[model samples]
Target: MVDTATNRVALVTGGSGGIGRVVSERLARDGMAVAVHYAGNEAGADEVVGGIASAGGRAMTVGGDVADERAMAEAFDAVEQGFGGVDVVVHTAGRMVLGPLTDFDLDDLDGMIRTNIRGTFVVDQLAARRVREGGAIVNFSSSVVKLAMPTYAPYAATKGAVDAVGLILARELRGRDITVNAVAPGPTATPLFLDGKDEETIGHLSKMAPLERLGTPDDVAEAVAFLAGPARWVNGQVVYANGGIV
Candidate 1:
């Protein structure tokens, strides 16, 4: 068991499922007291927390809409109250609406902007203020930003905003010893990615990487663990976890 003497705390948004779930569990295994944040899936969040506790790690669940500033502030407060103070925050909450730019529903665009863009702002704003010195903040972007996939325009636009926010926030933190970075994963084997994709499409995307397979949630989690823990020198950048896709 890793020693918990350092008292590191982490808040993982969307920690109930997909990439966020693995990230939460990995951080817990690293000895951080984790606040698993979920927007609606209480059962899923509880399952993650339970798994951590079963493995002799400490964790709890926090729930709220990621884009709601007040709700997120409360979520931060809850983590602070539970684990002393937050040391790391991984904002994995996001939405993806795929369609050609000209044909995309305006409402779908609006939702993505709110969840992916505004949500990052809200979470990072509080993380900037609350995360302790020597801490880290990781936001999620997407390899699609570089892949420039046809229907991914709307989703990629939001992640493009995330990339910008992460870069600027790292510089803004200055001497605070907080590293800000974004992790962009490509064609990961998550429920979100597999939801609408057919076998042929999935196989094509899996083979896009030189690795010749879809990334696992654990694969992306390892990247997040590095950024959240010992990667003090890696700041203000996007670490693409896409297996050499770009």
Candidate 2:
């Protein structure tokens, strides 16, 4: 009972904000029906869905904690019921906490692991099953995994795990014609980057890269689009969209 005219469908977890928002909207504009997945930001997700629909693209918002299996299942069901099976899945939902290893709070570690690692596992498992053949899976890793920044040990650990999981997933899906890849972004100009930092600190961090500026959500989205669309031969690789901040 789905609309066969739109063969491309996408589920963008955390699509309510920042890089997720931009990426989801970009995919919709590219002619994919997008499911804007959000944890607790129903209004934000709705805004993204509304924007896409207003622009003559098909989109809908579904709310759930990405780390929760039951919640994620419901979200996926909404997508399947609303727009048929998924063709692409972009996992942009993750938790980022900063602390040195010595000072790493177990609670923070637990939360981040659940959201970043467990959440990705659940989403990827379902997406890999639901997405049609020749579809693409994009998971979010972090530049911190390569940069090894101080106070980001715990956060980086989670992303490092993401990198490994994504690569192995690519191999597991062999012959299915599905590609699994990870996008590791450096300090980008997203709300997550601005949360607790002042202007001067942010500027310094931005200049740390050779590009002399922080990345934009659109910049990351472009990389995701390439992997999702035409980079069929690219599989099991972490495309660092960090503007050379490695």
Candidate 3:
């Protein structure tokens, strides 16, 4: 068990990306020492870590494929060594390949399954074992899982599995004093979400939310901050950050 008095630590996978980057910084601002993990974008991860440091917060950078057990094990080891032990794990690493089911490439589907499904399992399994008592594990799902949007079948399938993992793991950790939950964000204005879209589609999605705007990375990050930091009772559930898109 980690000493409750020390600074809490967090390992955020995909800390280089849109939503993940914001989460890494937010956790740092909340006073946890953060390990910003990136699979490919080392520069982005560096920027996040540097910004945190600039803000007088504690942070470091680690890198690995979320699907690789050995790589992730090393990532965890580094964070444990750097900050005593991990208290929160907010897994935001994922892949998104949007297209209609009829024309979807089998290989694309396989890739999403690899990163989104298997990657989630690998990370969660480790968190279940390594996270300290009173720790939290937060995974990323998607609003598409609830929206049932077109061209999102493959992606949503992966997140549905994430939802399953969070719920079951919360039960599996029955008395461990840990909470597990998934955050499902709708139509966030991230590079990943905006990459191939046209203006019309973007406008439609923005309006789908009663807020009449797209969700920002910060918007979703607030939800994550609540789950990872002080929401001890919010376990085994999917928290929707979709701005009332339903």
TM-score of each: 0.97, 0.96, 0.97
Tens digit of per-residue lDDT, candidate 1, span 135-161: 999999999999999999999999999
Using TM-score as the yardstick, the better of models 2 and 3 is 3
For model 3, the run of ten residues with the poorest summed lDDT: 1-10
Stretches of candidate 1 above 4 Å error? 1-6
lDDT of 3 at 46: 97
lDDT of 2 by residue, 1-246 (tens): 223224689999999999999999889878889999999899999999999999999999888988888899999899999997888999999988787899789999999999999999999998878888878999999988988889999999999999989999999998888889999988899877888999899989989889899999999999998888878899999999988875
Residues 1-246, candidate 3, lDDT per residue (tens digit)?
Answer: 443323789999999879999999888888889999999999999999999999999999999999999999999999999888899999999998888999999999999999999999999999999999999999999989988988899999999999998899999999899999999999899987898889999999889988899999999999999999878889999999999988
lDDT scores of the candidates, listed in order:
0.93, 0.90, 0.93
Ranking of models by lDDT: 1, 3, 2
Compute the lDDT for candidate 1. Answer: 0.93
> Could you tell which candidate, 1 or 2, scores higher by lDDT?
1
* Candidate 3 C-alpha error for residue 81, in Å: 0.8
Candidate 1 TM-score, true structure as reference: 0.97
Show pairs that collide, candidate 1: none
What's the CA error at residue 49 for candidate 3, in Å? 0.5
